[model samples]
Structures are given as C-alpha cells and as structure tokens.
Target: MRVMVALIATSATYLVMQVLRDEPEIALEMGGTYEDMLLQSTAHFSPLIPGHIWFRVPKTDARLRFIDTQYGFITPAARFFTVSFNDNVITNIRMSPQIEPLLLDDVLKVVLDLQDQWRANGWTVMYPRDNPPFADTPEWRAKLRDVNKGGITFWQAGDKYQVFLDMGRFRDSKRPNEERYLITLALAKPWLPTQVE
Candidate 1:
C-alpha cells in the first residue's frame, strides 16, 4: 500500500510538471503589479491553498496587492480568509467582486480577522474617511444615507495601497443617494520571491 501510494504521488507530480510546461501563462502588458491585476478583475473568489481549484496564483507578486480596502490583503501564501461587509453585504471569499449576496445577515469573520491583523500591524482602520457613498468629493454627502448600497474596487497607486468603494441604489431602484470611499494604506509588494511579508 505504501509503494502504491508513492507511485500515485510520483505520477501526479510528473503530470503536473508536464502540464505546467505546456500551459499558457496570463501575461498582462504594462507590467501590472499585483494590485493592478486584482483591481481591474471581477473574477470569482479563489482562495489560496494547496490542491485547491480556483483562480491561478500569478507567477509574480505584481499580480497581488499587499493591502486592499479595509478587508486588508491576503498574504500570497495565506490560506485563511474572511468575509467582506459593505452595506450589510458579504463579498465573496472564494473570488473577487462576487458577493455571497445572501450572507449579508451573517457576521463578517473575515473583516474582523483583517481588522485584527491591521491593529496588530498598527494601521488605523476606519470608515467614512474619503468619499461619501453618493458623492465623489469630501464636501458632498449623499441625501440617501443607506449604507448597504455600493461596490468595491482596489488598487495600488504611487506609494500607497488604495481601496475604492462606490455606493448606490441597486439597479432599477429610485434613489438619489450614492456613496464612494477611497482608502489608502501603507504597504507594498514584497520583493522576496517566496515571502508575503
């Protein structure tokens, strides 16, 4: 039985190496760093883990961010994940921009984990810092103050990591209020090839 298991494992390893040699890589022009790829993509949730099936981890760190909105950044090698809350909505833990939709009533363990990590790292986590839900500028407040209507985007601009939160009524609704929040963080892609620190 031991020999049989070893044989299976060896054959599987060989098969994966063979496939990787033949697979086409995702190559984005402009040399986009990790943050750029995640910001522009609306791909489904893909948790980073062993023997997992989801979005492929990029070959370079430029395809991931060191920090995202208040959700914080998932270490390239970290396996655990948390929920995202915006206006009482739970964002996807398996992929990006794909909200669980029904899990808004559930507690956001992911957000809390992120908050804990941030506090451990000494970052000030707060909301309503930049743009209001319905307006782009700091001076304009949305007439409709409902918190639950919005979208989220992320990126790394210059020396800071940024999360762009946009809020509005769901499609076909009659509401004049909209909201947006852009959060900036102090972080960067780790230069080490195998380290997420």
Candidate 2:
C-alpha cells in the first residue's frame, strides 16, 4: 500500500515537471503583440554593455552603431546588429557576429540556438533550400553561388511576422575565414495586408 502511494506521488511529480517544462519562459509583452515587443526592443541605441533593451519602434531615422569611444573607432570582433522601421513598424533587423578564427561549427551552433528560441516563441521556421522565396531571381542565384561553404538561409512565414536568416559568406570581399551571419526579422501591421490586393 505504501509503495503504491509513493509510486503515484512520483508519477504526479513527473507529470507536473513535464507540464512546466513545456511552458515558454519569456512571455510576449506589450499586450502580447509581436510588433509591440519588437518596436519596444529597437527604439533606443542601447549599448551592449550589460542588459538588452526592448521598446516600441522610434519615429524618424535612427541607427545604432557601436563604436569604441576611447579608441574612436568601431569595436573589432564584436557582434553588430541594426534595426529598421517603416512608419513606426518594424521592417528589418540585421545581426552580424564578429569575424574571427572561431570554428565554423561553433558559430553555427549559436545561430541555431537563436533559431530554436524563435521557433519556441511560435515563429514558423524554414530552411531556404527547402522553401526558396526567390529561387529564380538573379540576386538569389548570385547569393546561392557561395552557399556551398556553410552558407544557409532560414525564412519565417506568417502574416504577423517574417524573418530571414542568411548565414555564411554572400559578399565578394568577405574572406573565407570571416563569419558574416545575418538575421533579419520583419513585422507588418495586422491591419495591413502584406500582399497587394
């Protein structure tokens, strides 16, 4: 009888753990809207010194470029990211890590982890090769030419948000050892249709 009760208690505990594990750690803020969270996060030119910031998109033209104030130049081998907004709505986000002698696999792992996080937050993810957006376009073709060397692309499709991840070298001047992974996320207002009617 005691054994049975203990077994049941353990089973209940396991079930509770599984349920909690499935829950998302970071809940969407700003009335639970993706656009709101994005806008808030990209509003300021917050330095990468400590914690990150989240806020609504800003009005007018704004750009955040990290520079070494003491050295009077841009930081070397540091991650760089830019966000662009259209009419106070998020249009683009680009993130690029510093190029160094790091292992390609290690760099890719970091990007993949980010992809997984976005996926967990309910973003539909796809590999570009599997679902090419502009496969026939000359520009896409040119970009694909160098995709053999660890270049990859991911596209997220949805009316609420669209994201693109272009990893590896797609530029002519980029060296083989340089890591130029870029992640771009765009969000269109719910009232506005992305497709022209």
Candidate 3:
C-alpha cells in the first residue's frame, strides 16, 4: 500500500508540472479561442463578469498557480489579468499590476518589454516616431498626461493587429474616494478599439 501511494503521488506531481508549464508569451497572442487558451496555459480562469475571464500567475512553489503571474518571492505582480472574448474568440487580453500609483519608469519598462515580445512575434512600433530612452521626469509625466488624453501607446503588425499600452486612472469599487493609477496592456484585432475606461 505504501509503495502504491508513492507511485501515485509521483505521477500526480509530474502531471501538475506538465500542466502548469510557462506558455503565457504565446497564450496572449490574439485570435485564439477559449479552448486554445485553456490548452496553452492549462490555468484555471475565473469569470470576472459575463464576457471576461481572469487568471493570476501561479507561484513557483504552488502547483495551483500559473507560471506567468509571479514576481519576486511569491509576490503576484499581476492583479487584474483578464481575457475578453467575443463569440468564443478571444478579442483582447488586459493586465494590471498589483502595485498602486503606477510609476512612469516602471510602466514604460513594462510597455517596452511587451513591445519586445510583440516584435518577436512579427509586430512593429508604428507611432511616436522615436523609441524609448524615455525620460522619466515630473515634467515628462505631466506632458504625457497632457498630450495623450487616454494615456495610451500602441504598435501595429502590418494591417493585421494592434497592441496598446495604457497608463490610466483606476478607481476601486470598494474605496470610491480613492483613485489609483495603473498600467494596462492590451492586444486586440483591428475592429476592436482598445479604449481606456
């Protein structure tokens, strides 16, 4: 009985590891179906509302967490990681970090990292005329806020798809008076607008 139990435990551990393998880089690619998302990540997604589903990155020590959401030492950087679907096809992916008062430097880094990933997958920066070496100053932040009303930056792949990075105001439902800022990254098809709301 002891030997049989040990064998079963080993098999279960291996199965869980195989299921939780890191595949978020490809998983976030646009135009996949819900089943494709499930097959790729094998992470459990909770329904945020009617059309949206949310998931967090699983911790390294925890078998239940997905591999994409982990930060340093079990901290989850992504707080609101949601996927929106329209008619069973994934329309967009949205994610915000757990930290509040999103800093301009950190937000720019995230956007640049995302841009790097998109470039690997055949996308290119199409706007702003210049690439980063972005100055993170009080004046620069204020200028960004002033010029881009929606606080959004985007890249395009041919005429096919677009990726948007938004650093926008977010209000907590539980704390109505407190306003927080967050960076949200979204991937969408041409028909869907990545609106900041």
Best by lDDT: 3
For candidate 2, what is the TM-score? 0.39
lDDT of each model, Cα atoms only? 0.32, 0.40, 0.51
Q: What is the C-alpha lDDT profile of model 3 across 17-46, one tens digit per residue?
A: 675464222244456666666665434554
Q: After superposition, how far is residue 13 of candidate 2 from its true place, in Å?
A: 24
User: What TM-score would every model get versus the actual structure?
Assistant: 0.26, 0.39, 0.52
> What residue pairs clash in candidate 2, if any at all?
39-55, 39-56, 39-57, 40-54, 40-55, 40-56, 41-54, 41-55
Off-target runs (Cα >4 Å) in candidate 1 are 1-72, 75-99, 105-107, 126-159, 165-197
Please give the distance, in angstroms, between residue 151's alpha carbon in candidate 3 and its true position after superposition.
3.5
Model 2 lDDT vs. the true structure? 0.40
Query: Could you give the candidate ranking by lDDT, starting with the highest?
Result: 3, 2, 1
Least lDDT summed over 10 consecutive residues: which range in candidate 1?
A: 98-107
Question: Which stretches of model 3 miss by more than 4 angstroms?
Answer: 1-28, 47-77, 97-101, 129-139, 142-150, 168-181, 192-197
